[model samples]
Target: MVCITFMSTTAMAREAPIFLVAHPDVATRGLNTDTARAIFAMRQRTWPSGQAARVFVLNNNDSVHARFAKEHLAVYPHQLQLAWDRMVFSGTGQAPNLVRDQEEMRERVATTPGAIGYLEREYLDDSVQVISME
Candidate 1:
């Protein structure tokens, strides 16, 4: 039993990083890096994501989203933590929708069309084009 459990653990550890995707069409027309930053920062309201500019989170453990947030959004996870803390404890911009994994993010973005989120560079298919950071 212990050996089997360990094998399963190793299998899951080999899993790939999450990839965020969006419809290729929405990629050009909707938020670019700057606009995405603004949207993530709550500076810009509304987007191709019907959910008040869906700021897709690449799983809670994703470093990619953190890097993007710091580099483009110019904010750290702590800021978001505080923001959400306030929003939940008080009230303001609603909390971002949580997608369990990259696949879910892709599905959400593909169906909604307005949603924007980050994904692993590998998961990007012709379905969604990556918005280059400026």
Candidate 2:
């Protein structure tokens, strides 16, 4: 019974459509997948419009984090962690700022200029802009 419940909850989270969200002040409304991937991977430091990009993320183990990683970014959570780890260890870059949950994800993205993160539809509000991924 417990196993079935956990599976279903995981299934539901995977099914939820994740939106790429950014601060309202970010100039671009859309980004190519490669650029988005680079930003999240800490390889790209600025938005196309030349704004310094600040990336936020939920905990690596969070279901929403896994879903957004695989479904939207075409990468796994473990892979992202490894990339972040490599950057941190080599002093080339740093890990993204971690938010505790979707509420925090939305709040941080909304408040920070050039911020980028993902959220489910329910957590979105006027303070952030939904960025379309091509």
Candidate 3:
């Protein structure tokens, strides 16, 4: 029963759709789940087209960020934080840029070049273009 419960939780994370969004000017085909995961994990520094990728995220405790992780990246919030901490401490990579909330996420992504972030359908607008998952 415990094993079943753990498996279901992992499966549910993979089953959710995580919508990826980017600044309007960043050019590329839609990203596959692996690439998106790499970017958010701070492993991939550029978009597929070779343009620098400026990754952003809300606070780890934010509900939207939590959903984005479980659904989009299929990782838990603590896992991501640990990954970031490891990278930063080792001088291997920098942590993703952070924003306070969805409102700030929209503003920063809209203005920053090569920016990538996520938002719910309702918070989306003309300022950014949604990047479809491949």
Candidate 4:
């Protein structure tokens, strides 16, 4: 029998915590499983203002988004792709904001009020609300 092991060098190399940054006006913080599921699922498609929700996403190469998606969003990357496709074909809306990395996502969300996204749970800050995963 042959055995194989897979490892991610970036996972080990992430020296700082990942933060899901957002705009300043949002009045929410501290995420639980429910909120996480809602935002990530695109079920809550719009902000209270009626503006469509802007869910930012990190690159698939990033492990942090995967962990958050599986734990809180209840969906994997494949599911996310299917979701994007469904929305696109239906003309309901496109996928959430796609940021090349966490930093870009945070910066984008920070400036955009309708924006919502996830990063490593620990890196969140007061600049934005970290919706609960409950």
TM-score, model 1 to reference: 0.65
Tens digit of per-residue lDDT, candidate 1, span 5-45: 34566567654443334555553443456666666655566
Give the top-scoring candidate (lDDT).
2
lDDT of 3 by residue, 1-134 (tens): 35543456666674334468899999985988889989999999999999999999999998789999888888898888998999999999999999998888889999999999998877789999999887
Off-target runs (Cα >4 Å) in candidate 2 are 1-14
Error of 4 at 60 (Å): 2.8
Of the two candidates 1 and 4, the one with more favorable TM-score, higher being better, is 4
lDDT of each: 0.61, 0.94, 0.88, 0.66
Which candidate, 1 or 3, has the higher TM-score? 3
Tens-digit per-residue lDDT, 1-134, candidate 2: 35543456655654668999999999999998889999999999999999999999999889899989998889999999999999999999999999999999999999999999999999989989999989
lDDT of 1: 0.61
Clashing pairs for predicted structure model 4, backbone only: 31-131, 31-132, 31-133, 32-132, 32-133, 32-134, 33-133, 33-134, 34-133, 34-134
Residue 57 miss distance in model 2 (angstroms): 0.3
- Residue pairs with backbone atoms closer than 3 Å in model 3 (clashes): none
TM-score against truth, every candidate: 0.65, 0.90, 0.85, 0.69
